[model samples]
Target: MDLLPRKGITDDEIGGQVARIIELATLEEKIAMMSGHGFFEQIRESGGRLSAHPYRAGGGCERLTVPALYFTDGPRGVARGNSTCFPCTMARGAAFDVDLERRIGEVMGIEARAQGCNFSGAVCVNLLRHPAWGRAQETYGEDPWHLGEMGAALATGIQAHNVVATVKHFALNSIENARFKIDVRIDPRTLREVYLPHFKRILDAGCASVMSAYNKMNGEYCGQNRELLTDILRGEWGFDGFVHSDWVLGVYRAYAAAAGLDVENPEPIHFGAELLAAVKSGAIEPQVIDTACRRILTTLYRFASAEDPLDNYSIDLVASPAHRAIAHEAALKSAVMLKNHGALPFDKIEVRLVAVAGRLAIIANTGDNGSSRVWPPYVVTALDGLKDYLGDAKVVFAGDEGDSDAAAETAKAADAAVVVVGYTARDEGEFIPGDMSGDVRVEVPQKSIGGDRDNLGLSPDQIALIKTIAAANPRTVVIVIAGSPVLMNEWIDDVPAVMQTFYAGMEGGRALAKLLFGEVSPSGKLPFTVPASASDLPFFDRDAESIEYGPYHGYTLLEKSGIRPAFAFGYGQSYARFGYRALKARRSRAGIVVSVSVINLGEVAADEIVQIYVGFPGRMVDRPKKLLRGFKRVSLIPGETATLRFEVPLDSLRWYDASAKSWRLEPGTHTIYAGSSSRDDDLLRREITL
Candidate 1:
């Protein structure tokens, strides 16, 4: 790399003005400026030495004679090393624990910097728009507010380790249907109110780049949409980071530049010397080119270290004791119990011949590919977890045809069967979208943002297996594994107990085992409702580009349509019986102060998730009948009383006054309901005024 110093500009000037780099770089070189280099080559070992090429994998693309920045995939876990393969973000969200997510991000950041990676694109804080979306496994669940807080926390933690976090797909990349062709038509209010808040939160948390998606938005490609990229992000929000395009989203370099995308990755896709030439020759404004380059250079300058430490060091990643502990804690907390018909907490000390079914019961994880992928050293499967706890009893492992016991062996010889069933890592949900085969070098895909799921039910094989297994074994417990809610219409009645452990992360296995034995009482609450079927919801497709949303798709709409969910949001079951009593609320100048006492009446210690839901009972505006105001997670011993208090601001209680076009407070009475879940309220009818 060679450059002639500007006559009057000092080195300090170069540092201050990244805009100057555009003046000196050639047209072709400028186009080359906005892409990235690959890090991981291959995941699984095949034959000879693990080879590294393009994308740090097999091989692709001839060199352009210009050096580029290097990047990799991750968030939930590191991709390189004999690393512990943790569950993706979707799994982390099911934990219903924000602090756990931050810790997960911290470790991931530590590993990313250690691996010599520059930027971790698609930090994946986007809200899940459609449950059937295949990429739903890669994103946080339905609520934008939750996603914003959790995603922002993770982004903030990752940046602390000196690696740049790139918040991804800018806007509405949720649906997988016709992603490349369909245009997502969304209302400005919904876009600003519901969808885009998480993005803003991520950027404010110090993310350095915002990756553009493959799809079109409002008729133009999101990658080069000026209104979205420039007007909203650069102009309105004042986002200062680079705008990188998804790989292979080609042929719109000038339009994209004018629109405001800074770096077109894996280059020549909408960016190259031709676009640069167009900029200088009056075809495209030089300011667009200058602004784009400056943004990228500004971001790149923050991480312009020439040294590569991970070039040599290889730690025993999966073997590290600390990593395992982290995984264990995450797994334990992530296990969310949806149904407990007094069927759990079985006589663990006396039970004999415990049989377990399903491959996931024996395997480490199911969703361990793509950006959220991780490399775990040792996995404690469901069978191993049960066996480890019940050393005196015979714990048999039966790999069911699906989630059920069609084989008849696990049940034929056992006293009780615990069926652990799930979708595979290679199944519908998520992937890095490249050749996982050792053949072609696979880098992150710029085009493959999402996909559609296969179907919503357990396969015919799994259904039949569960029915047969339940008939044989009277005391059977079913654990359902999924990234999003699916209908359990077939065997819901037969399975005495059921738990939804949605892709619990690396340590999930231990957590699952702990919950089963009442060692750790169930605490996690549902973030999204479990629909009876996909047809019941308004937007339940892979690609929901052109859907018109109102109160139907979201909680407000579902409540109006009288469509009952199989399980409501924030639904969970606990081993110990708990009671919420004496709920009181006082409204002051600041807002409302609510207090409640949570009593554990059962015989064992337990973790309780106390949720405060607020309802504007009368004279209010458009709101979700009630919304989650605050929640507390605590551990309680038998007969222990935990008193909890929370202060709510007036702004939090204010409603969006559409006619006035501003947030306004109305003189109205609101009801404060204290509950374990949205479906069931333990303490009711505490009033407050706003």
Candidate 2:
């Protein structure tokens, strides 16, 4: 990249300014710039919870004209004001549309700036190690490659507006319930290949900042882990941007500066007076403090001197009509129809009377209002969506919280029934409470909601209601409104169709209505595998104080053990059928180019996600039977055929050799599986020799 002077400061000028500012500023002013000023005071004024507006989390140097870094929490939307809430990151991952996700990132960045925030903590790329791990919705999915690609797209898009994007919960912070105290143990190879790869990808995309995770990796907290912050992220990866601790309690020691933590966010209990005392006592070097402050100021000026996104980002930009439409598009593409027996696309079934039953049907349920919450202007429920879509048709909605019999009777009477069931804030999401024994004691702002789920299965009552409804109505469709995969064994066989409409978003209801009525085809595919049983996944105990993280999880683990999943990763259904043909794979200077012709067989326009998984010949070493190397989403009309090409880099197929401590491409014939899902039967295989 060329380093010529643009409208902003030049590289030399930035360096000179940082040094000059450091010398001119008082020690107190430098430390003050490293933390929030009115953060806790504002929260206290709002009575314990942050108000629906941007909160000053860090950065303020009035002497140098450096604006206080106004930060907000999220992976959904700008978690402040009436921002347009798109689907959760998990939902966007399911969409598997990088371009769409980028566009979504653009809107989020635009809205964040409109809300007067220059920094965004919205790119959450943590791997979904377990479905029951409450904050699973905040991240992309279970696989590192998929998470990396999607996260990179988002980071790129957000930074396009010069809104310094921050990729958060830095390394191995998957579990929610015990995040504050959990110490995750993992081997170097597994950590590099599976867990840390995604973060590296985001850094490669030139993300402006990083927030250390709350949990400990190995024996040390992430905020103060010298190996992670200094040795790997800065020294090895060459991430020039600043690294900040997660808000409040994210930093455990005053010597965090020595470990490369550039800033302490929120009120900064650890890095304030304690840090000043440490410096005076010669326990910490003043050079370490200068380096930390310099990094923050350098990253700050990088965006501050750049051009503003647009003129006067008025309040109207937040959740405006155009943004809402983007939200609708996100929800439309993210809703994955997992199973269908010709029971979907309500218009095709000749239904005049419809029945909608569920506690979540008519509620303004978007997601947990913890750190990632977006208080939209309004939310449309599933019942509202169905009623609005059904217009003049008779629609019956029953929410007998405990009367399954009455709901069953209503289902029996309707022409077709849509049963909405799944977890809400009361069920799961970023667990903040240390006490999970029912008696709650909240000390400060919590990152979690109801905490990690008790189990993956649906509640007993919801299961019974689903079974009863399915028995009474042969044309029943189950709509799951969860953040992650929900095991559906108890009643999956009873229902003819199932759709995962993740905590869709503010405009989710409208999107759900559009999808069910054949106005739009369901194009989302499973980003993570839904296992036959929870036992098949890596052992996950959210409450465990210390946990060993294995190398494999999600589809990789299930495939390695030869255990079948309920629905394999990348599996989804559409009203329009798709056919794959003419599979070709060849090596190019760029990488392996795989081309395939996709045809829409049905009489409706739809999108098909073509996934390519590379399988190494021989089982001499531990490896996933196949790893997702590349994928593409193509749209086609009725009887339309389009050729889609995917570039799979040779590096993507390399293995992390623990002994060598580097990536190595084992010499073997690599088998490429090209088709819709991870299931072997669903793909067309072609072998390529290295």
TM-score of each: 0.85, 0.95
* Each prediction's whole-model lDDT (CA): 0.65, 0.84
Tens-digit lDDT string for candidate 2 (397-448)? 8554488889999889888888899989988887655332121233444343
Please give, for residues 312-341, the per-residue lDDT of candidate 1 as tens digits: 333543335776677677667666777766
Each model's Cα RMSD: 5.4, 3.3
Q: What is candidate 2's local distance difference test score? A: 0.84
lDDT of 2 at 370: 73
What is the Cα-based lDDT of residue 600 in candidate 1?
A: 95
In model 1, where do residues sit more than 4 Å from their true spots? 1-28, 37-69, 250-253, 302-319, 391-393, 402-406, 409-412, 431-450, 541-545, 551-554, 582-595, 616-621, 645-671, 680-687
Best by TM-score: 2
